[model samples]
Target: MGQGLSCAASQDHRFFSAVHFGDLETVNAMLERDPSLLYQTTYDRQYPLHIAAANGQIEILSMLLERSVDPDMVNRQKQTPLMLAAMHGKISCVKKLVEAGANMLKFDSLNGRTCLHFAAYYGHSDCLQAILSAVQSSPVAVSWGYSRFVNIRDGRGATPLHLAARQRRPECVHILLDNGALVCSSTGGYGSPGTTPLHLAARGGSLDCIRELLAWGADRMQRDASGRIPYVVALKYRNGTCAALLNPSSAEPLVWPSPLKFISELNQEAKALLECALMEANREREKNILKGTGYSLPSPSHSDDGTDDNISEASDTELCCICFEQVCTIEVEDCGHQMCAHCTLALCCHNKPNPTTACLTPPVCPFCRSTIARLVVAKMKDCNDADQDIGDGGSPKLRKSRRSLNFSEGSSSFKGLSATFGKMGGRGSGRIAAENEWVDKP
Candidate 1:
């Protein structure tokens, strides 16, 4: 038994060495002497085929395959030779392996990841394209109807699109999208549920990825397990260009309005004006009813005032700086400048002070002019609550802010806006304008 094992080990070492050093002549000579050495594996379970493919020894790989080496033979990691070639960007080797009937859908046992996933993860655009072409052209794929391999998810529920986006491979992203990879497909796992390719692109800070994803109809509003959208992820990672592109307000101006559409939009404005009037009238009627019942609406101060009146007495404390109406209920993190919750939500959560204007790039504290890292709701006590010290010494108990609001709900409104705007004949023109503006910005 020991002698047999030693002989096997010696043969494995020789085969692997020849493949690794790209000694095609030596490999051919060895194979001719002992054809069974083709099946010998290294200590790591890597066969001669795996080594040659990994090292881009295309000639050696072709020879091994021609000798009837198992193209789908898995090593210790359950990775086939095709996967090895695709991962290392050995495009010729990948083509040869696929042509020899290597399985494209075969996944590594460790991660349930396919060759395309490895190619995308490693940013091998050419290899990815080759694999995609192979799968699409395969006789088995056509007969067995397995074209969905392009969008196959791995153990982490991440598709090749997700991996490509995460790796910031714009060319890979484009290839996958063109090949029917789902743009809105998300990752699955405890770490980041519902994290779509767009979210990955935003986190990677790749402007090209962002553009490709958005162009391919990636859902920007899709939230992860942490309740973060692509825009929020961009901001979290300090990807200002991506955040700006994802900003809803800035996105509108990119699409130029057509003259005919502009004329048609006047009808929508008239309808909106009518709706506003009706809403105001309803509110006035409610106020009148309250007045008739001898009850008055409480002032903003009454809702937020704690035991200490001095905090409210501070200069510029009566009204929020952003809205200049409602009591300040939110504070800029690190700066402690107070503003109304609505204004804070508009600025921090939506990236704009008002819904109509473009979002601010590199958001800053309106008062201190300091960079606004985040926004938190200030916990306020009602007049009936017990006395509590409100000081700068301790961390403030923050109230849940607008970040928790359902992002889907906000995006639904945009969809409605788009539909409404599209009917006005400006859809095509607006999109062209937006695309141009996005490309021109510094």
Candidate 2:
């Protein structure tokens, strides 16, 4: 019975070859000569759709779909073309299949994993996000619910977040968390059965993944089925840097500010600014945690173009009043007070959210007691006497503003962060002004 199909569609060998190698010309001629080739399956009943999709032959793929090829067509193992595209990290093919109305919830028999699972487990974040974006508006989301589908499990009861963490895919972990995957959900079969995403991240020894998971509220204290916490798992895997962060004795991790509607809803630029500030501050804190240990900090995990970070830039308004060493580029909305992005982050991250808490108190402005509403990239102001030499024939030159410095040389470890935090929130009026004048005397 099988010998006949194999003998007849030995022609399938040619058709698959053309689709796989992206020979659109040959494929078109073959289709014109034998229209049945477009719909024929190979010896294993693999559709032409799977070959074109897996090989990333977008031109041939689009042609197949145009000629009534099913995007969701599967082979013996029940693996669809969309799943194959995601498995191979073929983002364009994934998008094409998605646009052609492939079923996102279809699970392959080998692993009981959907396209999302394949994308995450294989570290294809772009493909993962594409599937998630489609699920948001698809009828499947309404029926199964969006968040539920995002946290959907595979045969081993591993969520996409768990797979991303175990595979050291930090960006995929971040994407899953952003799309409502539960950060602290425990696995049923993956890794230690009861292992959480944090546990898997610790075992994988990816500090970047740990940062992403912890910032999204992953519980480090959560235990696996064998009663071992993430810290123990980190130490078990010999991940000293990860162990240091997971250590209960170390300083608290900086969490993403999700309570402050203003901070949480900031635009992409502001968000990136806050993220860099958070990671840098955490890096500095990690130094203390690794004081006597042999482990050192790793290279930064993501690219930072530093469009708004100007601490080292030669701007007159570089020093922030709060930190006195960083550029004051972020502004509080209604209060109109400004501070360095780092210190601004410090205030928000000072209070870490409890993963089990239902509500949280939003942080207040240090300068004023007003509820901190929003943060914006403060516009650069010319804090210098730009018109100092504008006088025509010495018609009285303008006065120069007192030069601001990165605090003073030989200052204490904590400068503006000391007891003088809020008293200097505003420009000092009488006493401090007189002191400034006395100190600036030539």
Candidate 3:
């Protein structure tokens, strides 16, 4: 009784300091002198083995385990030494802990994060491999070590896979995917528009990760609670390469319903709208110019020329506003305004240079200049909100207004609403022309 009490008193005094200094010899001598001291814990409920493993003291860790010290004893924080070992990338300590049958799937008290969650998060591939091997051999569907393996969410419902994707660890993503992590796990944080791993990949700008997720059957059109698609997310970030990748037909035109077809249809609708607008503007100009003035009848030479020929010629001379180049193709935005094709393409990208001033992501309706979605704040409410009416084909219903756009008045060289046409004031005699229909020759 006296020997036991003396050994206990001596160990109690040295326990905290010995563990802190990683004194394997003192720890072994104490354990040898009193075998029961192996179970003696510190104030924080950490066994000698726990501290050794946490601090990456592999020699002391191995000795403690060989003497039958419990490897699964958690600290007051409810974190096993294994959790610390994995998190800190201690390969040898991780191996000792795993070999000792430490609870691989044990969750931390606070975040409910498991050891694999920690290992994968910190990119400890060797330790992760050991854990996976142990996991595969366990009887439970999710190994007991991973029983709480971060497959489920916290109060917010973000899974471990979600965290990995967000952290942008490609290797971690691969490991999780190989270990059967769900690709489509959703969170309440985003509502029905909860972000999938692909969403995280999009946010991380990992093109390879994005492709891998897609190969694993990630839905490209899967929208978040706000109905924002992956490509739309890419656009808001100004990732043009991703935007074009999502829409295969953007580079080379594809068949029906492709980006090209979609763009073409939108262009036609915009042209029809522009044609009506241009006619009105032309009438106003003619009325303003001819008002209170006596005009002579046109000569036979002028009268015989084709009106269509002149309008076609005039349309060809109009330059793209953003690029200052002659327009190639054109696209109309939700705001009922027009821009060159390249400018429209640039606006929807997340990777193009200098996008804020030149690009037009949604929520900033390209034409009306309204903030569609606040990119800076990451708000991606669906373009078709209940408050905003979407027409038959998911296009927003344009608000009607008397404000009309005039080609000459808005043109760079047209100089303050003058009705007189200069000799070199572009091809058409007096009218706006359709796209690609501009007359190249008289």
Candidate 4:
């Protein structure tokens, strides 16, 4: 009996190793000779499918699944192959498992974390997106509902958003927010009980995550279980850079204009234009906070070499009357008024993000002050006609009866809108967190 057991153990090790290294031929040969090897598992309860998926051995994984191996099988830790694939950032493996009908909602034995949690915690944005895409077309959407699954709590009551923020995965944070994850939901973990994603981001000192959270309407004044707000948490962790943004005394960061239905339905290119504008405005606020200190922001181009890929010399008619720096690329419908994309974004996203848009109103055109219902790409005009609209500065040569972008008529630039922008005229674009200067000290 002992001899038989030893032989079985050796064979199992060989088969598992074959699967792990993607030696599909050896695995197929072993499985063909002894089909029962498919039923065997290591002491940790891990199977050949788990090994193949975890190691990104897609061919071997597909073979095992084709041979009747259960896709949702869990090991001792209750982690399915799908969870392992996502945790390891194996995007191909994740997609394979999803298509194979692996259960995305299954939680691991250790943390009650689903594959979504694993993807977010491990900073695998692609994997996270894959799992989310699966949920939309799968039964998980029907039974558990898409929104509930997105904000599903782990054993510690932390959602995927919380994990992504705590891990400093900014792209994951943006995705979660885009998909309707509750921005202000609190975690139930003892280590950071009642902690919001904002608090975790501050603790981790990730400015990008913090910026996304604030843009989604995360409350800076909300306290955690210990009565500590994100600002206090940032200061405690000695994240001076993060603390500056989290400081409640500073100006409120601009929120995503979720209040406008048209804003959400904009074409991808136009929407991207506005989104860049939103981030640009908040970056300007961050620049103010870092000034008079040891820190120095890079020039507007964001390149140390000081060149902007987004900017191009434009004719006078194409110039943005507000900034005089960039072209008037976006237009308001009905009103037929236009501004540079930056000023358009600055106007729409300037309001702090409200959780709901029902009680809110759309922004009006700076020119006609009419309800600015729609925005589209603007048409460029002839230089001769442009000369008639403006002369030396960005100020309009022909003034409408209503107040002009409220400029003093001679300022030549956006500097005149200090009351609205707080003196932001950033070559009209990008964010400030690219420097990674917000990192916490060791």
lDDT of 4 by residue, 236-322 (tens): 999888888888777676677666766876777777777776676567667767776555443441222335435544453466666
- For each candidate, what TM-score against the reference? 0.56, 0.80, 0.47, 0.82
lDDT of 2 by residue, 131-206 (tens): 9999888998999999899999998788999999999999999889877888888876534549889999999999
* Shift of residue 353 alpha carbon in model 2, Å: 7.2
After superposition, the stretches of candidate 1 with alpha carbons farther than 4 Å from their true spots are 1-11, 143-147, 188-193, 252-442
After best superposition, candidate 3 residue 353: deviation in angstroms? Answer: 41
Q: Pick the candidate with the highest TM-score.
A: 4
Estimate every model's Cα lDDT from 0 to 1: 0.63, 0.74, 0.53, 0.77
TM-score of 1: 0.56
Candidate 4: where are CA atoms >4 Å away?
Answer: 188-193, 295-314, 333-337, 350-358, 367-424, 428-442
Which 10 consecutive positions of candidate 1 have the poorest summed lDDT?
254-263
Clash pairs, candidate 1, are 254-433, 254-434, 255-430, 255-434, 256-430
Ranking by lDDT: 4, 2, 1, 3
* Cα error of candidate 2 at position 208, Å: 1.6
Tens digits of per-residue lDDT for model 1 on 1-442?
9999898778768777988999999888988898888888887898889999999998898888888788999999999999999888998889888889998878898889999899999999999888877776677467655546877889989999999999999889977876678888878655456889989999998866776676555666778878888889998998765676665444321111111122123344332332222222222222333433444443221222333223332322234433333455566658776655434433332232333654334455555567765555555445223113322322221211121132224443433322322221111121112222222111
Candidate 2 ranges beyond 4 A from true positions: 1-7, 189-193, 300-318, 351-358, 384-442
